[model samples]
Target: MRLYNRDWTRREIEERVGRIDQIGGIQRVRGAEGVEDGVELVRIRTGAGLSFDVIPSRGLDIGMSEFGGVPVGWLAPGGVAHPAYYDAQGEEWLRTAAGGLLMTCGLMNVGNPSEDGGISYGLHGRVHHLPARHVGVEGSWDGDEYEMAVKGTVDETSIFGDHLRLTREIRSRLGENVIRIRDKVENVGYTRAAHMLLYHFNFGFPLMDEHTKIDFPEATLSPREADMQVDGYDSWQSPEKGYDERVYYHRNIRSEDRASVRIRNDRFPAPSGAALPISVELSWDAATLPNLIQWKMPGQGTHVLGLEPANCVVEGRAAERERGTLVFLEPGESRHYELELKVNPGVTAP
Candidate 1:
């Protein structure tokens, strides 16, 4: 493992620290406050300055993240609310939607609030607030390399309804500044079920400033709202008061199996005294997540960017069915999705 400034053997690393945790490891903690009380979080530190919190009480989704003492994830004003506070009504999900590093949306629905057959669907979905079961965490050494992982299962099921089970695993290495999210959604019930999934990855503050650059995959882009299109649609702006959010959809991305987007900020200086930028890149299996959604909102106190990968668009479930883009899984069938996030402290700019 390469920690600090050079290579470290297992013996050398273990000898330096009385306990492995003295350098970096995983810890299970509970939120002890109003609304956030009883929330179980698995915090992992990669020793390489990458640390993040995974909420098992909230569908195994990731919360806050920081690298080199700098926060890269967006934390909403609502804090980390417990799953008990989730409301599935129209747009009510936003109330407890503690914006974090990654929020998993949907098992049955995604996007706009709509009703079908007298059943109402919420803003994003009910997955983010669903508690995970069979949670597991492990940090082991593979030869000289140290690998850490957290795994759990979250289900969005009800009586006579969809019985979708989502098994998620988040992995990272001791000296690596990268995290991978692996998920498999299965229809464990006896009936075929509709499935919609979207990974809402958010970035804010130091990572998303005025001069930040966003490099999206080459694709055909279209605005969600036709009239909201502007000249510099891909460029960001300074946070302005009362600014409206803009949504854009990217499709037909030109990539060989995997599609990615990079967000970079050059304001931070590196050890080499070069302004090479501190960047984060998200890449996923394009075959499963063929569409990308960009949520650009540079509003005062709400300055955050959400880059989402999904099988379905932001159109409601009903619209997805009407458009024939909704995915369905047969009984006992499963679908797998993989996504990786890499943080590069630009030793050499790309």
Candidate 2:
């Protein structure tokens, strides 16, 4: 069988079908008129049955993801909130959390509210609420494979406070159910600055039901709160009427250079009745992101499982500093973080 393109030149046609490969593509679109006004979105489709939306105005966060027409991520009912509506107080950030596949936390602070050295820091920091500057999206064919990416910069600064910059790139390849995120946080001020970052990957609904199970490397699991229940840390429960959220810290001792985790729902089938078992996998460098957090909330209308990898915990910057685990970047210094999310199909439990 042969394919012909009437719109392409001879050379272009040859390049198009040179390797029998599928090329992924990206498109820029305006937010829905009444749903997400004043927001810009980039819709990406990898020929491998993976698709997602990226909000360039919201720190380039992934707004939603799907595999074979089935949503793999959760979204807040409030939709995307503009930066002008962001509240730095506790719990107020949730009003505009978006709750997508990826919600980047931190550039200055993260976690619960706290007062450190007389400065009050709010919950989960302010990076996600900040708009990205110099946003650009592009797609290209790399050798026999096609790749697409969106790049941008987010600045978290003040007149006399910390001045940090985050340059982020979200990339995906054709015929691959994977999304890769690369970030570089630089201290642009004249003094050392405390930095915290967390990649909050949230899954919801059919992908995160009671039958869903989380698998991670052998690690020490510590409850965020002493009174928190630990009945089934690796498995989820049905959504309750008034269930309280639970947080656990996974301190993985990697036997290799990299650490990985997976959330699989073997009982969930593809929307097309295909034998594609649904699963999401996260892989990252253990040295860069030394901490992992599992946020389980099985509450009605708020069901989600967050697999967060971070440089610090969610105990606020003050607590992290007190524990000497708060990461700091010196003037003119920078740090890089790499994370990958892969969607697996046709995989069954052992």
TM-score of 2: 0.92
The residue-level lDDT of candidate 2 at 218 comes to 67
Clashes of each: 0, 1
CA-lDDT, candidates in order: 0.89, 0.83
Regions of candidate 1 where Cα sits further than 4 Å from its true position: 269-276, 347-350
For candidate 1, report its TM-score.
Answer: 0.96
**What are the per-residue Cα lDDT tens digits for candidate 2 across 107-150?**
87888887887777778888998889999998875665567899
Question: Candidate 2 lDDT (Cα, whole model)?
Answer: 0.83
Q: Which one is best on lDDT?
A: 1
The count of residue-pair clashes in candidate 1 stands at 0
Superposed model 2: Cα runs more than 4 Å off: 1-24
